[model samples]
Target: MKKPLLIDLDGVLRIGKEPSPHVEKFFDLINTLQIPSCILSNSTLSTTNDVRQFFEFNGIQTKIPILTAVEAAAMYARLRYRRVAVYCTDHVKSLFRGLLDYENPQAIIIGDYGKRWDFETLNYIFRKVREGAELIAMHKKRTWKTAEDGILLDVGPFVVAIEYATKKEATIIGKPSELYFASALSLFNLELHDPFIMIGDDLETDIEPAKKLGAETIFFNSEKGFTQEAILKANPDYVVNNLEDVIKILKEKF
Candidate 1:
């Protein structure tokens, strides 16, 4: 019997540049128990390969599949729009290398650029949009925590800027979008009722979407229930203080 567990990256497994406490023990337990797991992150910063390297660097042995919004967006672009003008950090830019021409792109894809956001980039994107280019965004998260600031701006504001300039909405490819969820599930060849769990820190992006897909959900509370109010509205199956609690529940349930 194969039990599927979907885990999020940011707050549940790591925070900023540091790995979460007990993450190593958690992975060891998974190996010891022989439980199958997958990492499904909403982050658009890194590619799936990069994510795998991060886990390996942290000494967490992960053979399970890794799905990220960047991969999802790429899949979406390949299916919908082939030639795209991307507005992402250089790290993320490397993922789409050779996929886009940038000479006369048909679409504008936006993601978090961190400190690289500036007037020059914005003007370039705006120029493309004015020329009738379509817009696509990874996720609409307003802000995310970083080592430099308590809360750094995310891709949401940039999406808003483009929309404000061009008056055209972006096709979202991340959480709250059923396409991404479906793509993740397809990788496991599992159905909706196949004893699956969604574990993440964000209530709206991770928990609600998984619940809508008929999967049981676990919220990894990071900000002391800052999202609890919204999560209670959706009514997840379980809520935990950290990933350790998630492991405990799996042990009892499975």
Candidate 2:
């Protein structure tokens, strides 16, 4: 069995507020095999612990902790900058409480800013970065899942917009971010090359990044199968339709 499995939350195991079917079975596999695993998500809508609690309440329970982009940002922000300007929902912004600096900040931490992504607000953040504040994006994921809207534009688009206007790059601290991946693996006492696998929905942020770390990646596509070109582009070790299919792959490969 894999020492630790890195799993993404949204789209991979759940969409919006609903947990995907067989999510409990997925956790059961890890537990039955005595494999260590943790939940990882790019969304900063809640703290890692909050996400875990949500999972337990919804039907999945795991002793393992969640590795969230917000927590990663909080850790990095505490060490790197004393004062920073943050852009995200109220729940997410709470992660940066003591470190926030609205005026003349040292860095600008951005996440799912939701309805405040208009031109005027973006330009205001641009002004901060232009004046020498570093940009720390939670993640560059392109889409966000919603119960009502299905999939919609996510923070990646807005972050890119600000980057273009300011001619500055953001330091991402979530999925696909090497440091973030490394940080999650560390919790399991596993290094980059250790025996592990990543199971997630996003080709770019989930499967692609795990491949970069030299770990086996299982791409969780929605339809019956992924395009051959998409398969070649992602080069995922395996692709499955849902989390339930992972049981067979683990039995075969691990």
Candidate 3:
């Protein structure tokens, strides 16, 4: 059997609302080769089905699996806490359907609250954490880019603020988190020692964390203007500027 593969959704498969160039070809290559793969997302704003729909709408249909931070956080929270307060968009919040408990919750699950984030909300979470509630953060991404707004702040700063106030670190359930990657491996019935490849754009969140999990990484250098020294520091197994190159590399190696 071919080695299992893990792909990042945001920068690899899709860039903002536009699909990455040649992404369809990459998926076709995987399907034709029967490579086991799963697309990983750090999006606390959307769920697996939402991602699936986006791809389908874009005409990049495939049977490959997907796991989003929202779904992972819900699963993690469900396993540990009975009552939880989820902070995320309405669609994303539906994942934690049965577990939402704003009043006297056992834990506070923070995600992409968007424009709803304010002092009152932050203070509420802080007070809850002080009251001994566990803090669960979807992904601590400091910033992200948008098709309309360019680059904007993400959920990380808020999570860190709460951590600073409460003196408690929130359990991160997204990319760069060991638990998140481990959970992805489980989808393929894989163990840590099993061979795998991780492809993504971000060095800190994607490359470094996957490396720690023993995955051969392919850095999709989507953004231009990275000095050679920075790329060398990341030390990915392979570096490519496009998804079509990923297909070629996989064909040659696997």
Name the best candidate (by TM-score).
3
Report lDDT (Cα) of residue 199, candidate 3: 93
TM-score of each: 0.87, 0.93, 0.96
lDDT of all predictions, in order shown? 0.79, 0.83, 0.89
lDDT of 2 at 211: 85
Per residue, candidate 3 scores C-alpha lDDT tens digits across 131-233 of 9999999999888887787777899999999999999999999988888888888888888667789999988889888888778999999763457888899
Name the regions of candidate 2 deviating beyond 4 angstroms: 223-228
True lDDT of residue 225, candidate 2: 43
Write model 2 residue lDDT over 223-252, tens digit each, in one string: 424477987898888878877788888767
Residue 160 alpha-carbon offset, candidate 2, angstroms: 1.3
Model 3, which residues run further than 4 Å from truth?
A: 224-228
RMSD of 3: 1.4
- When summed lDDT is taken over every stretch of 10 residues in candidate 1, the lowest stretch is 223-232
Q: Return the lDDT, model 1, position 244.
A: 77
